[model samples]
Structures are given as structure tokens and as C-alpha cells.
Target: MNQERFKTLQIRLSGLSNWLITLAVIGILISIGLGWLVKGILILIVVIVITPILLILGVQWWLKRNLIQDKCPVCSQEFPAFNTTQFQCPNCGEPLKVEAGHFSRLTPPGTIDVQAVDVSVQQLED
Candidate 1:
């Protein structure tokens, strides 16, 4: 998956998870209002128990799907990365950008270049 698609998917997943949690909370509140205290507690327990497991599994699946094994363009150091588009090279510490599953060194900003000139000064004796 490309970076843009991956980012969209990530945002969608975040929204979905938020909706699911909201729904769970509403359900628990409704159960408590109906005097089903035990049921509400049970639902809370289930959510607490299952949410982390589901999140872990989901992240694992995402990693497996988007993991890329490639070499850093500047240092040729091979490493694995998710399809996040930009990251630092572990071995070379160079900022790397990814496109089409290929890595390249990220260039500094254009404004970084500054003109330099030698200065000369004459001092008179005090």
C-alpha cells in the first residue's frame, strides 16, 4: 500500500475504533439504566479484556501487510519499515523518504543555503 492509501486507512480505522468504543459505552449505560448492573459490569469487563487483544491483532495484521524490506538509498543499509513513507535510516541516521517501495535520501530545505563572504576590517591604534 502507498503512503496516502495507508494514511487514509489509518484514519478510517481510528474513526471506526472510536465509534465502536462510543457504542460500547452507550450500551453499558443503557444496561445500567435498565437496572442490569451485572450485565453492564460484564460488558465493561469484556470490553476491557478484548479491546487490547483486538488492537494487538489488528496492528500485527497491519504490520504484516505493509512491512517492507529495503535498503537505505544513501547507506545501503537494509531494514524493515512499515509503509509510512518517511523515516530515518537506522545505520546511517539519514532522513529517508520512500516512494513506490523505494527509499531515497531526503534533501534539506531550499532555504538552508545562505551566502557567505569574507569580511575585512582595519583597526586604528588607541
Candidate 2:
């Protein structure tokens, strides 16, 4: 029975490792395909196609292997680990509680501040 249990455990671990590698490979493939298809799309495809898969795999592996809840305090967003102490809520600006895990690589929001050009000039006396 002990040997059987050990074999089962080994099989489970090997399966998990294989799954993670598959996810990483798929993400890379999708990213490359997107880049080739869209010349100017930038990193949008990565965010849309790859992040969710990685996040899911990370969260699952972390939760199962480590007997702790690695989740964001605010918005209840779940992560693999809480490396960062502070995180801006993805849904809102409210700060979330982070454990000792690294925060997701979030892209900063883009903004445009337009300045008006002044047409008036000072006249000089001749």
C-alpha cells in the first residue's frame, strides 16, 4: 500500500509539472502568432491570451502545494503569492493586501495631457 501511494503521488506531481510546461509553451506560441498576425498590436495579445492561463496555473499550483490562501485582501483577487505588500485594486484604486509573493506585471494606465499653444505675443517699442 505504501508503494502504491508513493507511485500515485509521483504520477500526480509529474502530471502537474507537465501541465505547467504545456501552459507556458501555449502562451509563447499564442504570443508569437499574435505578433506575426498584427504588426502594431503591441502587448495586447499577451495580456488577453496568456495572462489568464498563467494566473490560473499559478494559483492552482500555489494553493495545492502550499497550504495557505494566497489571495489579495481587496477585491478578493486571487494570486499565486502575496510577495508585494501593496497592490492597486484592478477594479478600483483601493489598496489590496498582498502576501510575500510578487505582484502581477501590470501595465500602467495611459493618459494624455494636452497643453494649449498661446498665440499672443508681446509687442516691443521701436
Candidate 3:
């Protein structure tokens, strides 16, 4: 288990480094392409302006698709599950939080009588 985890970490680090290098190479290529073409505005625009933006976008795509680890919503720690509500965060014991659902209602009517929060938070009157 420890070896597997170590390998996973190593792979993640390697991927990050690779993406950074790719950005650098794209930058160099853009500069060279601009110098070679010398198409004035178009050259500057395509190589100087567009390539870096594309590099940034590509890095984002790669990280989102390949690298980001799933995190526990409550404790904000990386864990294995893809969805929230699988279990309480093991580290913090807080129930896993989930994104708001469509028309999500906090409490069903008639389930509990909610009094003013300023009042005692004891169980609602039956």
C-alpha cells in the first residue's frame, strides 16, 4: 500500500513538471515562429499572444482531466471517493458536504417546527 501511494505521488509530481516544461517550450516556439514569419501584427498576435493563452488553457485541461485529486468537502483533504456524502470526513468527523441540489430544500415541511434561531436550539416542539 505504501509503495503504491508513493508511486501515485511520484506520477502526479512528474505530470506537473511535464506540463510546466511544455509551457516553456511553447513559449520558445512562439518566439521563434514570430521572428521567422515577421508578419508584423499577425505574427506577434499568433505567437506572442495566442500561444501562451493556449498553453495556459491546455495546462488547465490536463490538470482537471488528469491530476486533481478528489477532496473531502468537509475537511478539504484529498480522498478516494468521486462524490460527496460517501461518509464523514475521516480526519474531522464532519459529515461530507454536498453541492446544493436543484430545488434543494433544507427541511421538509412538518418534519420539524423551526423556531427563531435566537431562541433555544433545543429540539423543535413536537
Candidate 4:
């Protein structure tokens, strides 16, 4: 399968797992309220055991999909770009914008230049 399709599948699976877990928890609660303490405990135990595994797998998939190698435009240094559009280059401290899997330097704001001049005043005699 292509990378994009695989990533999309991973996201969908993660959401499905979350919904399943929610339903399981609700079932456990209902079982306990209905006086099936042992059944509820077993289901709770199963959920507790499975949740961490699903969470770890989901996080691994997300990190792999979101973190990408990118080169800084100013310094040409390569770094991992997380899920963000704007970031600063670590090597040269330049602000950068990410678009279409490419990095570009951001334009700095314009500033007005000011100059100081000294003036001499003549005193008027009455």
C-alpha cells in the first residue's frame, strides 16, 4: 500500500479502537450495576491490558507519519519538522515557513531607520 493510504488507515484504526474501548467500558459499568461483579472485573481487566498496547502503537504510527526530514533554507541544515507550518531554523536562528514539503525563509518585518542631528542656536542680544 502507498504511504498516504497506510497513514490514513492507521488514523481510522486508531479512532475505531478508541470507540471500541469506550463501548467496552460502558458495558463493564452496566454489568457491574446489574450485579455481575465478576464479569465486569474481567472486562475491566481486559480493557486495562489492551489500552496501553493500542496507545503505544497509535503514538508510534503518528510520530512516524508526522515527523519529516526538512532542510533549512538559510543554513542548509537538516532537521525533523514536526506537525507545524512555521518554525525557526535551529542552526542559523532564521524564521522559516513550510509549504508543500518544502522549507522557505520567512520575510522579516520592515523597520524605519532614524538619524540624529545636532543643531546650534545663536543667542539674540536685546
* Preferred candidate (lDDT higher): 3 or 4: 4
| Ten-residue region with minimum lDDT total, candidate 4 | 107-116
For model 3, how big is the CA root-mean-square deviation? 19.6
Better of 2 and 3 by lDDT: 2
Which residue ranges in model 3 land beyond 4 Å of their true spot?
1-41, 71-126
Q: Pick the candidate with the highest lDDT.
A: 1
Cα distance off (Å), candidate 2, residue 63: 0.5
The lDDT for every candidate, in the order shown, is 0.83, 0.61, 0.58, 0.82
Which parts of model 4 are misplaced by more than 4 Å? 1-35, 108-126
TM-score of each: 0.45, 0.22, 0.25, 0.53
After TM-score superposition, what is the CA distance of residue 36 in candidate 4 from its true location, in Å?
Answer: 2.0
Give the RMSD in angstroms, all C-alphas superposed, for model 1.
23.0
Residue pairs with backbone overlap in model 4: none
Over 4 Å off, model 2: 1-37, 68-126
| Model 2 Cα RMSD, 1 decimal | 24.9
Cα error of candidate 2 at position 37, Å: 11
Per-model clash counts, in order, read 0, 5, 0, 0
Q: Considering every candidate listed, which one attains the maximal TM-score?
A: 4
Better of 2 and 4 by lDDT: 4
**Per-residue lDDT value at 19 in model 4:** 90
TM-score: model 4 vs. ground truth: 0.53
